[model samples]
Target: MGVIIVLIGMLLSVNLSIALDELPCHFLDSINITDGNRLANDDSIEFNGLVYSRKQYAEINYVLLRDGTDQITVDPYIRGCICNIKPCVRLCCPLGTLNTDDTDITVCQDHDKGNKFEAEVIHKNNETKVIPLERFFAYIEGIPCNFVYFDDDYQITHKGEISRGNLSTKLTHQNSCLHAGLNAETNEVDLRLLTCIELEGDDYDLNQYHVIRHQIINFCMLISVVFIVATLLAYIFIPKLRNLQTNCLICYLICLAISYSLVIFVTSFGYPSFACIPFGYFLAFSFFSAFFWLNVFNFDFWVDFQSKHRFKQMSERKKFYLYLVYGFGGPCLLILFIYILDNTVQLPPNMRPGIRDGACFISNILWYFYTPIGITLTINYVFFLLITLKIRKIQQDIAAERSQEDGSLMQKALNEKKETCILYLRLILVMGLIWIMEIVSYLMDNFSPLFLITDILNSLSGLFIFILFIVNRRVLRLIKERWQNLRGKATTNDNDTSNLISRSAAFMQMNPILTIK
Candidate 1:
């Protein structure tokens, strides 16, 4: 017994000896910085350059609780360090005085554990209802529990969705199941299995540790949007660029611009919570519209390769209008599908659009957004294959039999198609690689250090479009011609005005008496 006492004393001395700075800082899970939220540890937020490990935060928070420090001052200094139980959870932390579980967060598991519960809850602007949920806690310590997820929209949410388990549940119902490690003056770190849930509790405002990172991302996206708008203007103002092909390019750029701009707006925190769904819907439409137009561009090229429609550009106005329907209208249908799902009661909680599930915007990215994008990309690939086959057949036919005029016409059309194909290829390569990086980053939870690569590529997409379409030799040549025409017309108009003035002066001088009358 004396030896045991000596060992315990040594352990106490060791714990006391370690300075606050020596505690191990929890590593970031993703550079995208999910709901983990620049956490200094499981309990404390890294605030005003202050940091604390899980053990350190709990101990300090407990000390403050004993000293009667109000939550008003404590909230900014700590997150997930709860004295009250209503909003905090203990299941993830541990129950009982000596429970040594190291789980730092009250995160929902990917798979539900044990039996599920049908939680009776208030539906906002609607009647009360019972939601069948699998996971346990509605709150992770002091903060409302958030889902663990990887998605494409890091900017709009700048965080993950708050856990749905707690979303609709009433405070009383939520309080019952909620548990968190508390520093309430106890023999050791205290845990209350029950009776700790408060009627009301302090709200923790999660401090954003690196605000500059998000600002830089938004600025880059805004810059890309400006370039996209510029490309649209270049195409629209030039009459020579109003051909069906350029019109298609214009449509794509317009959608691209709208999407990028919306990204800036939503992420900038310029809108209210009520506007999240609509913002998400429009953003989805713009992105899908851009993708659909790219599909139309590919399809138009494939048809041009067919000898029968060698001059498809001549009567392409009608077809271009139809292509607009497919481009714009298709995304409408997709958005409609999402809305239907969002409103549907039969769908599981996780499968839903999740715009409000946690982070806002279309949170179920795989189902609502990327899936449609993948399908469209696959169709574009098919068109690419067909174009390759058609080109081979045309070359064979031209070699086998052709009159001088027919061969020349065919050869000219062939060169145009080849040039257009190269342009399409470049566009596809850029967008495709970006999308691939995005998916990889979304799925790669372990590679926090590498999120920068994918994010930079994403922010540079509009800039990529500017380079691919606007900076090309053909567009530049047309811009040059348009500039010279404007200059020539300006010069001619000036000369004509001078000549008229001179004639008027001569006439007035010759007939001064008549002019005075």
Candidate 2:
């Protein structure tokens, strides 16, 4: 693993608008002073007791210089903060205490009476030790480091994080990382992190960061569910908006809501009971249906624009009914097929949903869930490309037709419908991008809040849909008209009752002598 020295806050400002070829930041590997390959921007590194990737340090100044002294490089696929300095890492850990309550640092010295800092060490033989930092590095100088710290350190009680620069680190100030190649056996990157050894720290304290991350995610999920429900209610109450275009959206949102609600349930309460099995399958079915329905929406758009089609003979209502069968039914069929394979065949642990093994969330989410969604997304991408190219031809044809009739009423209506289709297309694109982030993060092994923004976006997708579909001028105007009509009906009923009472009284007066019980 190559270690790049990080300079915290010393960078000169340079215009970022320069051509990619001309821009000379630690971008050129040929000019890199470091004698080995550099770490990718996605690799995690720790500094000042906090763990994060170079990509996450957006505030840190990292002006790359032309000289070959900098170890950091701007990867074509990912970028990192660069510094022009010799690559070195501060090697230190919390000093040992007499006991859990001891307030004084119990200095453990070496042969020459030089100070020795306690560093956790785990060897290939599964033995763990709490020895001096210098000795520990000597032990791991030629091996892959994967130390899982336990509280059983014979002579050390790990307390605080590997921070406190004011504390003594003079012994490790000159320590530099050894260069190494990637280890393919364990699918592990040769990442030489300057972070502290993985120690048994306070679980709550260590977990608070992740807890807040999940809270943000849940908050957005609930917000989306609320808006999705609200959008459905609007359509349910206003019959005018329940046509083919909106129905497609409704089916997609319903599936999404089901999937989101199920996920929230699993995350919040967890599945410790027998109900887990059913919940897991239902969750998969709902999620797959959502993607299927989304694809159906995209397909409908593409098919409608096409001139020669079997569905062209049928009404919009008929086409939508057929779509419903495929959207919801197709996922149902997939779930059944999976259930059969799971029971009959001896599938690998990763291939089978862990629901059969009593796990709450579907175990091995990628193979079972993402594979199908990936296929759906691929199809959507192809359809989207075709749809975009097809729309231009549609606009031109419409323009010619309008000119022939000087913008007839039918042409005007077609234009308005075309505008709505464009809006829905934008909605599809937004959903696609947000979902793509989830897939990317999974592949990248998201361990930190570096990709928290993507989760936030995904969770709040319902709000985005609500804003796009329900909170628009067209839907709002329909709601206003519906309210006004209801009010007018009430007023008219009251007036009719009053007229009836007046007419009855006049009839009685005009025929007072002739009146009888």
Candidate 3:
């Protein structure tokens, strides 16, 4: 009898262990949705919870299971069984097909048709002494089967639409999923999931395009730095290049170089949050300074073409000092005004100057940056047109006087007008094209192509100016002449050293007898 009792106790122990193992054990809170989406697609998760169905969708019987930490929708394949007494009346049926009018109590089944199930609960009870369903068997912690038939309000979450166990919507400035898989060894998707659903196809292509765009911009900036520095040095050292027009060009190059340098610096080494305001300030100032100097040069060109004697009366230094106020001081005043407005006025969040979309750029273009730039560009364009007509009229006058004057004099006159026209064309190509592309890019809804064009043109402006104005035949000639002069001076110094050495040898020879004595 003792042996039989021990055998019965062991049997009961084994049965209890099996029952405990089959009980709902996994907590919904511990599982990450992104990880669960990848690894637990076919895996069954069991949790203890109450099924809360939407009141309007009573026929479909789709329900949400809320664990203490998180919530997930259960599959519609779940079946309901009623248990009232020792022997429960088990009616196994699909979610929509369940006729619960005759039965008030039901235990959630693990499978649709099989008898393997757990978690007994009361369903649709209105009595005061009713017991709520405490245990729930969630087949999957994600969207229910046939989710497309559900209404829009059903899947909305704080982050975005909860679709197929993934947050398919995007938040403001969100880039990638926080819970995306990092380990390759795990059974998970390796690609970084986007924060938003890809409504338009070719998301990978778009990402690649942005990467290429930045690469091109960096390359152009590097080229601009090298050429602009060379141009500035040439203007400073070479006397022939130091006219009023070239001085203005020097200022423009300086501003362009600073702007490009700041862009590269911010891109390579990201600034802190506090640096955004200063960064925006300097960046806008430099850009505006560049445009202002370009306008100054345009006006100077028009002045030279329209009234040569009057332009010559204004000394290069005087012109530079006068234009400096407009070129540099104008941006300073604008920056000061913006700072005051930012401090005194309460602007919208979008209008404030701070880091947005991962870069320190002016967020409000219409008021702060673009408007001024647009006005300056319009003025420059008007000057450009007037200068073109002036050049044409000069050419016509020179042609008429060609029969009266010497051939050489007429040739020289024609050459001067030609040079003026070339200069104006170069200026337009460098400044006008870039700003036009910028304006078009700003106006367009889809700016992929326009942004590419704008970046390329704007970044290469310094290069264009250097090539057209600074690296020309005249500048090259000056550099060559200076190099030749330096070489001649070095040869003369070598000859002088040789003569001094011979003189010392002769003196030693004369004093040889005296030294011997």
Candidate 4:
């Protein structure tokens, strides 16, 4: 009976020891610093990091440990020890206080001396060795962490992540026009010997001088929204404006409006994961739709100039249907293809979406967004150039015909042709300029004055469209006529009301018994 009881006691002791040993250590990489900053005083956690710095003072000892994600200062105290001893003995430390530190370290904590903690240190062969407290925490080998790179302007340009043994990753700084080859190992990055390559063009500081630029862009977008709304209303209410050409313009305006609205929303509230999908989708779709409509416009303009008689013969409904397919349908297909690629393919760390410079934007701009836009813009620009040359030739022919003709009516017709040609030329020039600036800005990674110009022009695209198509002399005349008709109806109704009152008074006067009141 005694032997059985002793065996049972031994098994229970072994089980309890296993349970204590199995307790999980809290990893620094897993804990978000933003949330960890809010931890309660009584809560205990373990984290592992590389000891990057150490300071010894009469009062206390300070050690800075860097986990790939962040850094924290730890105060290692040896209880009941005086500074008189040349060799320090090891002791266990507890209840150390951590505060915030700001330096090259992404995030760091400063340890206060007021917190009482014990640490163990040993002296051997005239050298002092201390057991690493980090060993108590789990050691992370390779994991991704966000890195922010600031340019000369102090403006954030590149944001990405680096993991252990990632030596070939390239980081760019637009202001200096240089690229940094990262060497990462064992939860630390050494930027001491960076390789740089110079690029063309003088760089300017957007961070220092962006206030005025932002003001200009904001004003342009505000006016653009107003004009876009007005133009949309006119297209809906006016029957004469609902032709094939105007239909394409309406689609373009709708896409621009959606894009601009989303930009405002993201800049104001931010792009959290909860809102990222829908916001990213609509933003991309609108950009695609805008370019696709521009392509449709280029094609239509070419057809109109090349074969005016054939264009006139073609049914408006058929043209509208064709434009819809190319403008809306093409973008839809492209977006879907991108969506599939994003889901199936494994993306690099820098290409994945998350917080960048404290702002959330669609990641992988080169592959997912800019490539399609560049292709579309190239095709449209080619078409537009060809159309411009053709129209100029037509205008010259009309002028020559007018020179030979004797009638004033013929001269008037030639003048009208000249005006139409000039208008088309101006339209193409403005659109081309905006897109060219956009491409350049992206290529240069939005360096300086070029980026400023691109932002302003892009924001005011709606305003340009409204002025070119909606606020014309003919549209103004139509609006005036409509207003006059509405006023006439209103006045007529008021006069009819007065007459009915007069007739009622006459009837009451005629019938005295009926006028009892």
Candidate 5:
């Protein structure tokens, strides 16, 4: 096992580096510098957080140097800005002053941050000294640098030229990505700044990036598969584990495993090549996993508050049916509703903006952003709040019962129940917090680096449930006791063998006469 793990790591490092080298350098190098250019032609410069249009730039001098340096390559001199300029047409006013024709101009500014604060470009066989916002039209037409920022750290100082039409933007900053957005109708280029930092000596290769992404995806898929296989075996072979499968944890595990299988199938086996099916499977199953885990959490309230009155005497089959109706069935209904919405409104699995790993993934759609996530979060939050209250009540009940009882086993049991309630409350509260953080992080932005944080929270959430449900002391003790009982029964049977032999001998002695005859 140790040797296998080491070999896998080695393979990943070597292959990943090789694959990264295969991806296009230009694609990876396109990081968005935030507010890269701010036009400030007027006397006073106003610093707004974003780029302003030509109309707004007329009155205000805006200083917009791009932020998000960690994600972008910075060249101090080359920057783009929006400014207002006067056209060729000029009007003679009544006061004998010529009013120049004002027009919107996108000015490409080049600055020397070094000792030479002034620079010039030879245009039309004339050397023109660079001035702030002067000859805006000519500068826009002539100057070279389209994107610019300062490099604080000397990682990649390779100076590159930008062709007039060559422009791109990073759609997302999740990983160091460079995506281009262009307006074909107007022939305008809009560069999108991203927040992903390219690693030093990072050679971008399309095939390599795809392979790395596939491997990481495969690794995560493998985790899901292992959990699924283990869960299946535990349920099928382990009698005790099988009997203990009444919680939401198992339901979540089952759903997650199924979801992963679906993803793996679509991505690898290509069973459902239809766009809608993969997205539906991804959303439905992922949400189901979350929903069921929350449903498990809802037990805090149900078991404590409504357990006695609602389903206390209900048959096991009825309970199973009820869960299936609400728990499993609800997600299915939701998927159906979403599908209907998609079909009617011309929306389904949203195709990602850029080419993905040869598979169409659900893009960040409006529905995913607001509707499903909002609904799931609300459900989980309400469930957690209600469960927390019930847990407190359970603890109180245990305490009250213990106080009334004398020094009997009943009192001890009540005390134990109190402790158990406390533990359950802590567990549920922690679980709720984890989900809250995940939902919050996800909703905030696509470029959030906190995805790793959310992933960690998810992993911990699973680990907590695993420990609580399967590895808890009480559960272990139950298994141990069952094993001991089995051994005891076997030992008794073994001892009875001696008695059986003696009884046989006695029977043989008594029947000796009869036997001889």
Candidate 6:
């Protein structure tokens, strides 16, 4: 039931997005539309008044102009009206009141070829709208205007004159004819039909960013895959070469190697282009990492175990068993437990590969929530405690044996003890450090806000393995030794002539008169 609900929700959301995207480019039939038939501009239309003997009239037209181009012909569908409000008052002709309306009528009037006239919205539907004209103009400047107007004057001689100027200044300024009557009892002006003219600017398309981001994400996935494969092969094919194969360190490499490969494969190659990387890899590798460390932990156990000490150096089977129990067992349990939780409860967003972009690592759930952490800590603590007791007993036994040994043997035993303890401590420290990183990684994956920082730090897990295994002191020493050996061989070859000369001289001395064939 729950699965069905989730599926339904996902389908609905995706479908809605697709549906909205599929709509025609010209969605709104505004008075004025921009290029691509998108936004409405205010300058697309102009309304002008028709004058007569003491009376005037109005009409309007819709004009289709290419975005950013010159004005075109007027449309006949839209209409405008012009009327005189109060009787002709003061000779100064303070302001002309044109009817402000809901219908498409944009009025622009210059009372004098000299008197600067302005239009302002006063009484709309016979009620006072508190917003002032200047305030409204400032507010509307940001928003796309659907209507535009020009001053069209019809002469008494049946001739019309078109004065070209910004309709906004006429409508917004105080003294313009488009302004309402300030006198409250007089002043009337002529209003023409509102015009619709198409205008144009920026907001044309918005899909470019989405496309670029998608491609970038896919590119990252591809690169990550390549690196994963290369690093994994490097480990698998390259022999220990030195201290590279020493402890649970290989586990770290294996975890990262496998994790990234899975991430790339899941993200780059699947149905719908990507699939949620199955948590199985995380479960497997994380556990493997833990298990490997556990093996490092168990080395002390195997070395101190009665009769097992001799087998440790020679028996591969015993080593394998120790590794399996310590490194593999705990992580297996932990991963399975996490898997169970994932199945039973909704995992955190990070844990679940975005149904959109398929990849997953230690998500916020494991990092922030202490459930998995507390469990891991408890297990490690118990193992440490057990190992500590074992180590103490081993020390005690060595001490007892030391007292009975002769002076020379005692010294040898003491030296070996010191070396073992040093190696043991080093192993413990390295392993502990790796574990600490694991915990830190989990915490960071959960709580860290900076994505780039988290990503860089996440690489630390893999990087530590690469450096430790690929460039350990033991490995470097082996390389150096091999280089020196090769150099020595080359030197001997270079001395071949000297050896031959000595041999020839010796032969001549022995045979008094030596003749060459």
Candidate No. with top lDDT: 2
Per-residue lDDT tens digits for candidate 6, residues 1-517, read 9999999999987765554322121111122111111114522233322222211211223333422233454532322111122111111122332322212122323333313332322342533233322322211001113434433431100011112244332221111123222222344433332222333332222234333444554455445445545445554443432122233444544554565555445545542312233454354455456435644544544443333246445555566566657566666665656556544556664564222122243344444233444454555556556555654654555455554534334334334434444454444445455455656665565333343334434444444444444455544454454456657842233343344445544533443211111
Task: Give the residue spans of candidate 4 off by over 4 A.
Answer: 1-135, 138-216, 308-313, 347-361, 395-421, 445-447, 489-517
Q: Write the per-residue lDDT of candidate 5 for residues 304-379, one digit (tens) a residue.
A: 3443356646665676667666767777666555545544443333432111212243334344433564566566
lDDT of 5 at 344: 49
Provide TM-scores for the models: 0.56, 0.54, 0.56, 0.54, 0.46, 0.37
Give lDDT for model 3.
Answer: 0.54
Tens-place lDDT per residue, model 1, 175-195, is 223333333235233222322
Reference-based lDDT, residue 400, model 3 = 58
- Sequence-dependent TM-score of model 4: 0.54
Model 1 RMSD, rounded to 1 decimal: 18.9
Pairs in steric clash, model 4? 90-120, 90-121, 91-119, 91-120, 92-118, 93-118, 99-110
Q: Write the per-residue lDDT of candidate 4 for residues 21-63, one digit (tens) a residue.
A: 2102222212211112212553322112221111111112222
Candidate 4 local lDDT, residue 304: 56
- For candidate 3, write residues 1-517 as lDDT tens digits: 9999999999987775554321122231122221111115433322222221211011111233421224454432322211100111111232222212211112222323232222222233511221211122222222111111211221212222122334454222111121112232353222111233332368557766766877889889989899899889888876655667777888888998999999988777777665666787789899999989988888887765543246547777887788999999988998888776655666675676432322356667766787888888889889888777765665565565556535345445446545756775667756776787787787784346777778788888778877787666756766666567767732223243234435544533432221211
**Scored by Cα lDDT, where does model 6 land?**
0.39
How does each model score on lDDT? 0.55, 0.57, 0.54, 0.50, 0.41, 0.39
> Candidate 2 — what's its lDDT?
0.57
C-alpha lDDT (0 to 100) for residue 219 of candidate 5: 58
Query: What residue runs in model 5 are displaced by over 4 Å at the alpha carbon?
Result: 1-214, 235-248, 264-272, 275-279, 296-303, 346-361, 369-374, 394-403, 406-411, 415-431, 444-448, 456-464, 477-517
lDDT of 5: 0.41
| Each candidate's clash count | 9, 0, 0, 7, 12, 23
Give Cα distance to truth, residue 432, candidate 1, Å.
1.9
Deviation from native of the Cα of residue 508 in model 3, angstroms: 65
What lDDT tens digits, residue by residue, belong to model 2 across residues 1-517? 1222222222211333221223233232112222223346655544323234433323222334322234354532222222212222232222221111111111212222223334444455645565554442321121112221112112211221222234433212122222212233453222222322332466445456567888788888999999999999899888767767678888888988988887777778765454666787898898899889888988887776665568856898899889989998999998887777665677876677555544544676787777788889888888888877776654555556565543454344445546767787888789888778888887886654546878899889999999988887767877776677777842223243234435544433442221111
